[model samples]
Target: MSTTTIDRYRFETGIYRPPSEGGSASLLLRYTRNCPWNHCTFCSMYKTEKFQLRPVADIKSDIDAMAAVVDDLKAISMDIGQNGTITRDAAVSLIGKVPALNYHEGFAMLFHWLLSGARNAFLQDANSLIMKTGDLVDALHYLRSTFPSINRVTTYARSRTLVQKSPEELTAIRKAGLDRLHLGLETGDNELLKKIKKGVTAKGHIKGGKKAMVAGFQVSEYWMPGLGGREMTGVHAAHTARVLNEINPDYIRSRPFRTIPGTPLHAQVNRGEVQMLRPHEQLLELKNMIGALDVTSRVCFDHAMNNWRHPRSGLLFTHDYEGYKFPEEKQKVLELIEAGLNAGNPVSGAG
Candidate 1:
């Protein structure tokens, strides 16, 4: 391959995405640079970085560069006995030829994504909807056209941004091929919401989530279980359940509160101001939330933070991405929580 062709394989990627995207499973397509809302007390992600929206032209160029990587990989495959199949030998051969790929940030991610059937992708950094509607739509169109193998394109979004966007603009972006939104609804209690500086209220969470649903985006709402601690746990669970019931999103994920070291919440925890929940207490809180919940959404304890012991299995909850389907599996989930509560305190708290 020519030097120009080798250079064509360069692209930009950011550091974070949802766990369900799988390690090296989805291409890290950067639409924005960092977290636009970096004020969350509990968050340490993108704290030292500033947020920036890349130009649509630059974004499209990144897409083209990514496509060049795939094309070259396929070419290498064709040259080998694999006949265009993306294989280990082809990737090894490409790396051998272009040794610079060893130092490329997005190289391993892109190659593994192709190996995984290239069916899914996650837009990187924090929020993508903060971009101008026309620009977002243009980029989405270019992306959909460029990688037709990618059916699911998900992104992290602030609830406030969704509320600020016009209905028509959201519909336009949705129609342009953006599929799902992962919203961080840490807690629905007004006090905790304000304490975290989440930048959106319980009322606002419902409105933004409903708007996204109306605009044809599959919504995945995440809530932190012990965010309020013992003082506010009851209200937190009840109100969070109420909000989720109102939104009835496609997914309701549990991200148990883990105080990150450089974060404001960690300082609070150290100061004895914000107490973390014990394992059993966390389970009881989950029961309260699950009991109050009335939605058709999938309730997931997909993160390691949901650490508690089960009598039979090692973990209290299954770390399945598509968690227990609500309404049908609600009873089963409650029973599991009871089991965890009854089972001894040999378990550990992730937070």
Candidate 2:
């Protein structure tokens, strides 16, 4: 067998991606570095690191390098007479040729994405929409052309950035192959929005979300359930439902709040400035929000943080990604929340 070349297998990867994308075998691509906004009280991601937009040329190089690995892997498969299929044996053989791959952080993720049919891709670190429109469009074009198998490409975007982008520029990027956007709305109450330093108003969230939909991008908006603590929970629920109703996004996901130790919100909890909700209190807030929700969006409690369970079946609300189709299932979801409220088992944040 020929010596397996491994240099072209190198490509950069970022630390974060949404759970749905991560679980569904999406190819991870780093188009930008770190969070541009970095100031959210609840978020700890990219706090130490500064944001840098990768040049278009460098991004193209990453795409090429990833393609090079694919080509080399297929070559290995063909050399081993496996008819060009990416097999475990071929991967093992390549690793034998390049021992350093055993320590590569992204190698397993890349290989698994390939094996799972490479249909979805997620752009990483924080927000990709902060990139200059032309650069982003060019990168998306190059990526889509390079990996013809990828049908959906998504990235985290901030509502402020989306509101800042011109409609035409957003349209062009959507046409350039960026299919979906995952936005962190956090909370929609004006006061909570200020408290968290999310940098976007409730009005801005509605505008940005509606704009993304208008520009032909599927938008998944995430809101934190316990974001407002006890004092603000009622307003948080009411206003969040209000903003989401205004946007009517394609998907609405509940990411219940848990403060990471280093984040500012964690400090607030330590200081007794913010009172975290009790287990069942979280569901009561959800009941308020879900009851008021009036949208065509898919409502999801997809994250493990929504831990209140029904006494009979265990694990209330089926935190599955697709979740319940709303309007039709709204009553059912309210009933589940009621069940959780009545049940004696305390809410557990464990998966």
Candidate 3:
């Protein structure tokens, strides 16, 4: 039988690839069509598209489609192989065992296992926080009901949007099974925030971040080094570290700033209004920023976008011994890049 097929995954166009912090996987649902404040100079999430929200019904349909397939699996018992590794021939042979078999369910069961680690699910498409809290809660409830085995649920949120929401609203959201909130804090320097058109003041980030913490939600605040350029690197590092100290979120993530074509920051570069720091300079800035970190937040260098891709590459990541951690091992990465640049290699920043 020939059945129509629909692709289930979707995402925005950007130079970004998922960072490996803690090895968490990403899945895209695309609730927010584009960044609400799309003027971030160094960003390319929705550079060519107008910002908007995907309709709730459309989102519901996507979930329903997946659920429908899962429902089919509940109707019959497929054969179980050793360690649950059902080979294709075995799966087909098992499907033949059922009186009335479902191809959709068989395919979906394999996909479900692949997506959720056969354990938890990850939803994505930039900022799902743009969804109304009630709508999001309903969706979360639906997913939990459907999967029943999803251990943790998570999503991305903007500081400004989070700040605009009432604490009560956020608490209710927390109760709805949102285990983690990823906030792209880029840089907490007020000047850097303004320049990026982040639309949230440094204070706003702290306010919203604190609210999430108050609601018992784990918060990951992500930032980018090299965003301050040459002129304000010190101020940017110092201020960002200071802000993180105040927010003291569960995770402080670093994304090394890189140039992407068609972004506003690229234009700034052309006009000489922005300066992309050298690899060594960026490491110095990171060092300053890390040195200034008086707070006890766990620093993460997990993402592929980070200058330091190795989680335990050097002193920064292994500083639990002496109780001194800075850039955790980013200087080692910086030194490698600096050598490349000196040797006349293109030396683009790590992703």
Candidate 4:
């Protein structure tokens, strides 16, 4: 039992909210705190405390409270041009009807309506996947039935949980309308896996990812560049490629490593126990990863967290490694970083 409470949440802009969902427009609901499994060495997102599941009733009340203020919300949003050409009267009219709806059911409904047709939702805390499947299924169904317009419901899941769920269990949840899962498959090298306390092995990742794909869900495996640093860059790229080949997931997402102030990696950095990769070294690591890739998955470096040369370019496994030379892409990214260094950009030495 843990006693920690957060009463308000705001949507973060410019972060990947999963496209199968409506991307960034969905409200990022924080139903828990930190992460249940927070041992990943490169992660600094949730360093505050051990994870604890929020009380369902408490979450419901927050929704109810927010719902009560829907009218004020619309007015403020509209006044600030947030609703995009929405008139004050229109915002008020919508607010007047908000009371007619149940808060829990309408949390997502109001979000979609407020966004003017954008449809997706993200459950927060680092690992909403830690919630009981039954609870999640009911919550997701309530949102779906109440709104009818929500086509995508997404959450973050650790690889360990994915492996633990049986095929039938995953299928049941998928059928219940959980469409996408964003996995933090930071590295696929077993040695690096142990080094980072990633909580699951390379084999576990491969199995879990394949299970998600087998269950007919859109799966995105997030890979972290420069995670192995200068020491294990070669093995990291090669083994990560091996795992991806085995899983053949729908999307291979790139998240370049950034050590924040309070994470375990920061301590390692200070102790000289871990070395951060140079920008060009990271680019080569990315190239080796692409070259060793055997699956035809679409890769994305779309997050602002990365310094990809063509951030939107997709690694088609065929054209990306063959028709186009990855070394050239690497060079372009390195050159861009050098220019930024000359200009004194804050993330100058990063890629």
Candidate 5:
């Protein structure tokens, strides 16, 4: 075991990733410090921090440190294979030498990443694509070069930011190794978008999403069912379906609205400015949106928040909440929603 002066990579606190990415073996890499537009009323993920992009040198150093750890683990594996077992002293000595790689959770995550074949990496701390195009492209290239085994690279992008990027810039980013872009289209109702301070209109969602798809990036658009609340439910469902129909993104992920304490939306609920839809009402809204969708993309309800259940059977329809392919499973999904509503579940009056 030998000590090295590699710069240690420490993840910033208050990080968030997509729920669907939970089982992914992707290495989490932070390119930016936080969300650039932290004004979304329903979100509090980046409220405590201001956004800043890490310098290319800083990011590359972190990547280098990660590579060094991977190499060391490979060497240890070889030694263990030949020697039958590694001694406690040998194990402690080997790990103690790398001062920069001393993060306990990081080492554990890396171990799982390696076991999962190290085939993917996810950029973190929200809106990695908002970095300067050239810097982001360079970072992507360097990351891929350092870890050739990574088959996919993904990041979250705001619709407002995506609309600002030129087609050429997005294509270059995709070519540089970013395989997918996840955009939160939350709702396509203009009034609701303003109410939530999402800072993007329905048209913006369609334009931004279509641009990414045209640039050859697999696009996943997230929609929230109860975002528009009780009065706006029908409008929310109809308009959101219209936007997704236009973009025809590779995936439409449903994230049913759940209020977080201290958020502006919660305050509105307290003041009676907005009425949050009940669980059953949210499912009915989902059914309306699904029936209205005309696209060929897969529709997913993969998040825990979306696991709507019937009170009697305590079962979630569509077989385990994995989601269903649109146009094909639309009828079956609608029937499931109808069954849940028919169960005579009470809609809670508390927002």
Candidate 6:
């Protein structure tokens, strides 16, 4: 299946999202076409596409199309409930001949959104907030007005763009209805930040993150455990914890490094310029970071990539890793990491 540009909608969408959004019933609304700063060495999602902001008119039209689809689906449900079964022919007749509207990935997403109660939404593709503040506010307002049931709306944001935004601008955005901002703060170490081409310094991360929080938006800061490799692991963990302490974001999510093919980081690994940490080492690094954290933010090891092996059975990470509230469960999280370390598992390098 094509990863970008579903046909049912009048607009285009690029494939990318935070891991926390997975398995949620949120609708994926395409506000921007691709990553504005598609230069991060670890990301491969938007490398093939040029960044473009969808015109506000075009975005509104897409919102209208989505609303139409929802209305049609509701009508179909009433018909199906009364008739007992929905025939393919009947569905086509009711929903029209649009392939995406009737029988494609767009329809599948629409079905899931409806089934999931349409309480949340995620803006696409990479950083939606990079658009002009007035335009973004207008688009967000349109989105909420169109879907009154949506309780939360989220988007990825770059620290560079966000730091450039004034507190007033961020407040305007928050009042416009965006509830959450997910930042890929790969590491707080300046050297590691430069190595990863994250385009923001440690100060920039803290400033932008604090601005978002002050604007009343729940912020999720992403930390990569092994991004610094073996050489800078100590500083990576310590400085990341320090920054998180300063920002005190709503969520601290762990995205343990996984080298993907066709990225600069992968090239670095191949050339022996960087060495990935073994699973055990990564867990120990996480333990150290957790131990250093002094914030009220919730720490999450929920991503599949962060779950390492125990050498005995199942994952070293527990099921409650998603919302391991900090300070309260810090010791428990440390113990879990220690358990993984003591599991006698052979060191395995991540891809």
Model 2 clashing residue pairs (backbone): none
Runs of candidate 4 with Cα error greater than 4 angstroms are: 1-24, 59-113, 308-351
When summed lDDT is taken over every stretch of 10 residues in candidate 1, the lowest stretch is 1-10
Model 4 compared with the native: what TM-score? 0.73
**Candidate 2, residues 101-172: lDDT per residue as tens digits?**
787777888888899998999999899999999999999999999999999999999999999999999999
**Candidate RMSDs in order:** 1.3, 1.6, 6.2, 8.0, 3.3, 3.9
Instruction: State which candidate, 2 or 5, has the greater TM-score.
Output: 2
- lDDT per residue (tens digit) for residues 75-140 in model 4: 666766677443445445443544332233434444454556546666666666677777666666
How displaced is residue 341 in candidate 1, in Å? Answer: 0.2
What would the per-residue lDDT of candidate 3 be over residues 1-351, giving only the tens digit for each residue?
112322331122222323431232433344456566777777778667776776666666666655543443333324343334424444344345532335332343344353445454445556777678888777777667765766777777888878888888788877877778888898888988888888889999889889888988888888888887898888889989888988888777777787778888778887989877876577668778876776656676665444332322332232221222334544553454344334432333542
Cα TM-score per model: 0.97, 0.97, 0.76, 0.73, 0.90, 0.91
TM-score of 2: 0.97
lDDT of each: 0.89, 0.89, 0.63, 0.65, 0.79, 0.81
Q: Flag regions of model 6 displaced more than 4 Å.
A: 1-11, 80-105, 311-313, 319-322, 346-351
User: Which 10 successive residues of model 3 have the least lDDT summed?
Assistant: 8-17
Pairs of residues clashing in candidate 6: 259-351
Task: For residue 329, give model 2's deviation from the true position in Å.
Answer: 0.9
Backbone clash total, candidate 5: 0
- Candidate rank order under TM-score: 1, 2, 6, 5, 3, 4
Select the stronger candidate by TM-score from 3 and 6. Answer: 6
Worst 10 residues of 2 by lDDT: 1-10
Task: List the pairs of residues colliding in candidate 4.
Answer: none
